[model samples]
Target: MVVFRSGLFFLAFLVIGGAWGQTMATVDRQALAELESLAAQHPSSKALVLAAQGHPVALVQGRATVGFIGLLNADTTPTAWRTWAQAHEAVFPGACRHGVASFRVDANHLDVLEALPMDRLELASRAVPNLDKARYGTRVDSVHAGLDLPTAFHGEGVLVGVLDWGFDYTHPMFYDTALTASRIRGVWDQYRTAGEAPDGFDYGAASLEPWEIQLMGSDTSNVYGYSTHGTHVAGIAAGGGAGVGLTGMAPASDLLLATLMVDEAAALDAFAWMQDVAEADNKRLVINNSWGLPQWGTPDGTSLSNVFIDGLSEDGVVFVSSNGNNGDSNFHIEQTFTTAGDTARSKVQFYPLSAHPHAWGQNLTLWGEPGEAFSANFMVTVGASTEVNQSPWFNTADGPFMLEAVHVAMEDTFVYDVVAEAAHPDNGRPFLQLRIHKGNTGLGVALQMTADQGTVHAWNHTHLSNDVGNWGQDFQAATSGWLQGTPAYGIQQPACGESVIAIGAYASEYLNSQGTEVGGSPAYFSSHGPTLDGRLKPNVSAPGVNVESSLSSFRDGAYAVTEEVEFDGMTYEFAKLSGTSMSSPAVAGIVALMLEANQNLSPSDVRDILEVTARQDQATGALPAEGEVEWGHGKVNAHQAVLAALNWVSWVGHPTLPDNPTGEDLMAQPNPAQERVLVSGNLSAQSTYRLVDTRGRVWQEGPASPVFRIDLQGMPPGVYVVMAWDPELQTSHTTRVVKTQ
Candidate 1:
């Protein structure tokens, strides 16, 4: 009886085990070892570890102080996490569900989670870049048959958003002809800590009204000398030429401003709020980003920053970003090692004469293909002695190789972290990221890296020896031992996203004292690209060289170019500045014009239209080739784009329709119908009209008219194919109608 009972108990245990299934979670041994090492070294430094799935912790590992920003990916809230963490004295500064949340948990309490699991831990990382005038509006207006045409579109009813540094909202260039009202709808200064933040965001101050913006000039603290940068960019996009001599491409468009933050995460929050506000107001929005972070990993459009941009673009929000200004540097390389024992190496020297001295605190990064069976190491040489930091042979995991003062001969002058792993696992390639912190080394240092197998691509953001002056070049020895003639793939983040439109600078004309056209060419500083993941960027080029636009009223003396005229009774300033920054806004303003033409267009539609209608450079007489690095798709032609949009309405119809088209062309006075559309041209007495969608379903049908009014007041905002048939003429007409709120 006892034996039988024991056998029955064993059978029951197996049955219960099958029902329960496997419940063990995966643990990151590498991260744990790195954290333990960090605790052993810096006992007081605040360290934030990430926890993905709830993993189990054994004990307080070491004396090193550590904190955790538990990324609750499973199912939890910031409040709930805070409550649990607070039980052990954890602090919660903020939380973001749209992207990721940041929190802090003490190191002693960190060991309490013996069963916590996590995927990745982002410790932290830390763009002013310098574009164009005239030609944008000229091309756009001319493409539509000149500005004199009866149907002139100046971006009315659309919102042009500028995410930049300083802005002069009181400038007359942002005001109407009477100067009584400002085109600027709002301004959010993220640097200011004393005022109300934008809705849904905890940081930054807000100026909702134009009067409130003008009042900012007196605040003293908010008015900085840097205002000229943002002011000039805004003017190029939507200035009314009140006090400024040059007019923007979309003078009638509304302006929205957001003073930028240093971190991309903050940028994500700002974009989210701006987009939410625009959607609530039912306004078509276009954002111009003139800044970029070069230190960020891979221009493959897969970073968290690009992900946020993708999210925003899905909602019809357009982003125009600068490709960057690092065209002529040996900052990038790609090498392939076929021999089993062969190794690829590079020497990155941080010249002592750099404008940004102190390379000890900067990041030095490299990325490689995953599962390519590669090994990497870097030897840091300062003067006579050499210290090497290399990865373990054939290690599959990425790392955070921190170089402390005691660990190496160099003390206090600099510290850095060398890491190698897959930045985007979904992309099927691994990457190596190296960041040197507290880099105070006054003496120049050299970095030499080697990979065992496969292709190893490298980039050095900290070393800019060849970039001695503005628009400088180092063609002869820039690449040295690395591959040459592939300066492409240097595009900045966010713009690398598939949806964003990346703009580069092209010299519209070189002017003499009398503004004579001497010559023209692509700007040397315009960054080139076929992004890291191999995507052709800088969707198009625009005039950005020595372009004059509005300047800040707050900028005094040397800030203003005496050679350039200041208009608006000298109340506003105008200055000539150049960079991809100028070109970005120029393209954005042109996009605003496109949006004004067709509000139902998506991000892809806009990119395709711009590429198809772009004008070939007059100097080269060539358009951008399939994968041309610089001068992407040639210079922008605004008029052609708008005309293409108008033609697209006849061919592919609007984005509102799915795939099927059962409607014929019917002439409407206004293509983008706001309240009502008047059906007039090519109408028959006994003609009938039917309105359908891409789904092949008819919504409304009525008698065709020489003078007929289509009530679109109650219709949702989208594209509708209007088909009209005349029994007498035996003709059917189809047209696309874009409805707006």
Candidate 2:
């Protein structure tokens, strides 16, 4: 469920949104086309107050609706409408003439959307004057040590667009000023013409905007519930000028709010539209799209692609979307995101390794079979397997960890911590004990819904205590280290996102609730990567736990949690939300800062900054793969990224060779020798050299190049690298060589 700030929905609902104030009806193409043909007999469809994009006025067939919903088209002449209606008497019969389907419309209609004009939106730099602040580095650890919110990605100047639920733009935490036509630049709502829902809300005859709701309802003006998701994400991107919790990553970047409100088809079109416009506006835009179909299938049709990504490349936009908390279940993925030729990474989750063994079954049970039918039972409690003395040493032996079974019950569908402890057997180091916490609870009064509501999410109270790979088969059977999605065969989500920085989730200590500088470990549930095509995703990681940012749910008058604040004459509460969905934007904000420092850094450079600056995962003990999961390069380190952005290094991702090799030197003469090339020593008896072509085809091979020659007579002229492998001495080297006349 989308979260909201304390005591704030009364007013929010007044505005308008999905399902509540909308309607859907499929049109009859055959009948409608006939009506259009008649309407064409007139001047234009617009003349009838309901025109087709290019059709003319005089072609009419009949009226086609049962009650209040019917089509509205033009009639060239009053009598022609009757003449056409007479011909199609079979289908239209009695109600024949007027129009086919008509949804009531006018000034007060909910469908008369007050959509922010697409062309009217502007870039963000117009608002925050000090937007370039982060570009100038200030000591992070010494003065502002903690989760460095500001450092997550400097955003004083960059522009970011959020395609999420919706936002309460007026919130002070979000710099609504930046969202106006003048501030951060452009703002639009393609789903609305003047901000209206399909079915108008009958609030005593007139619909009300959230502003109007504030006057009549009990909702707070500052913190709204329900659709405040966009607002919260926006705050994380860049909110400023007040409060104590934390500031966002890019405090000055402009934001655009494009409402979807159940129009999935139209929204995809809008995504494409925005890409083109942002580029035209000279804004190197980054998008935060926290949505996707609940399911994905093979590329059976380019249907979804044409509207969302057909011409995205020329626009140079990048995006990051959620990998759905639904995890493996409900997530039918197997197809991958592979284009004939495209770049930019896409990311998803990477479940972590937990120390406890029982965590495996527990974790899988929750995520593996969502929407599946199953049964449950309990095992009887028994005495310690080996009866010990009645002394303290006697082993209770059964607990939350690995152990013999005690009494187990499935009284409730609730999942519990599978822990083991020593009980009553006295001092026998405690025996295996299975404790049962009972009942029907998950996802809406059930353990499932409760989990989705973000109440004590995974990697928090619900996941394994240790990494799953710790015990190998002792825990579970071996599978490739790849993070595969379930029903793994068709197109997976987000992987289809074109250039947006698709990020996987991971924890970082560099950002605080307010984006302050703090330090910590990685979040466990963040999506892992090496997308379908094997590109490391999740541009980078940022602190996504215990985050302190703007409040967008529950009202101020609502009950206060551990800490409380008052706003707009009300008091409310807050908590930290953790997920890769959260981390991606944090990085977006950081990228904004990088650009503010140097506008020349290409999107590729921006990507490299995050990857190269990453500190090797201290826990994983290996570098992230160039096209695999686990730490993508490593947990992001802003200081390092900033350094590389400053050209303190030669390139991104990895450092340039130090201008000289570290050890003994090896050289090759006539390197690309067509007939045979001479090689000198970097000696080791077991060393091997293989001449490989671009397509990975090896032309010749030999052991030890103390002074050997290679013949490549039939090979084409090109550039290649000679790889030297040594097994006995455990050494490897690579040198560039050229060939041809």
Q: Which candidate is the best by TM-score?
A: 1
Q: What's the CA error at residue 202 for candidate 2, in Å?
A: 23
Off by over 4 Å in 2: 1-154, 176-225, 276-281, 297-310, 323-492, 496-498, 508-519, 553-574, 624-627, 648-741
Q: Candidate 1's residue-wise lDDT over 551-649, tens digit each?
A: 776654355463344444554557778888888998899889888888887877788667655666466464423526787777787876775555344
Q: What is the lDDT of candidate 1?
A: 0.59
For candidate 1, the per-residue lDDT at 650 reads: 28
Q: State the weakest 10-residue window (summed lDDT) of model 1.
A: 11-20
Give the local distance difference test score of model 2.
0.37
Candidate 1 ranges beyond 4 A from true positions: 1-133, 136-150, 218-226, 357-362, 379-416, 422-428, 435-453, 463-486, 510-518, 560-570, 618-621, 624-627, 649-741
In candidate 1, clashing pairs total 39
lDDT of candidates 1 onward, in order: 0.59, 0.37
TM-scores for candidates 1 onward, in order:
0.69, 0.44
Query: Please, what are the lDDT tens digits per residue for candidate 2 over residues 1-741?
Result: 222332211111111122222121111111223333544453433343233211111112212111122222343332443344334322121111223221111211222222211111100000000000121122222212223233343454566776654344445555433333223243343222233321211101111243432232222121112444555566666665334445566666766555432223323433544564566667766666555432211111122232134235333555544432322222222212133222111111222324343342222111112121111112212131111111011111222122111222222232222222222111112112111222222211111111111111011112322211111010110123222234221122443343445554444445446977544454554445434333455445455544544555433333223334554555433435555446555666666666665566666556655654555544535552342353455555554455445442222242322233333244555432446666665657768887665445667778865666666677665544466666766666655444533
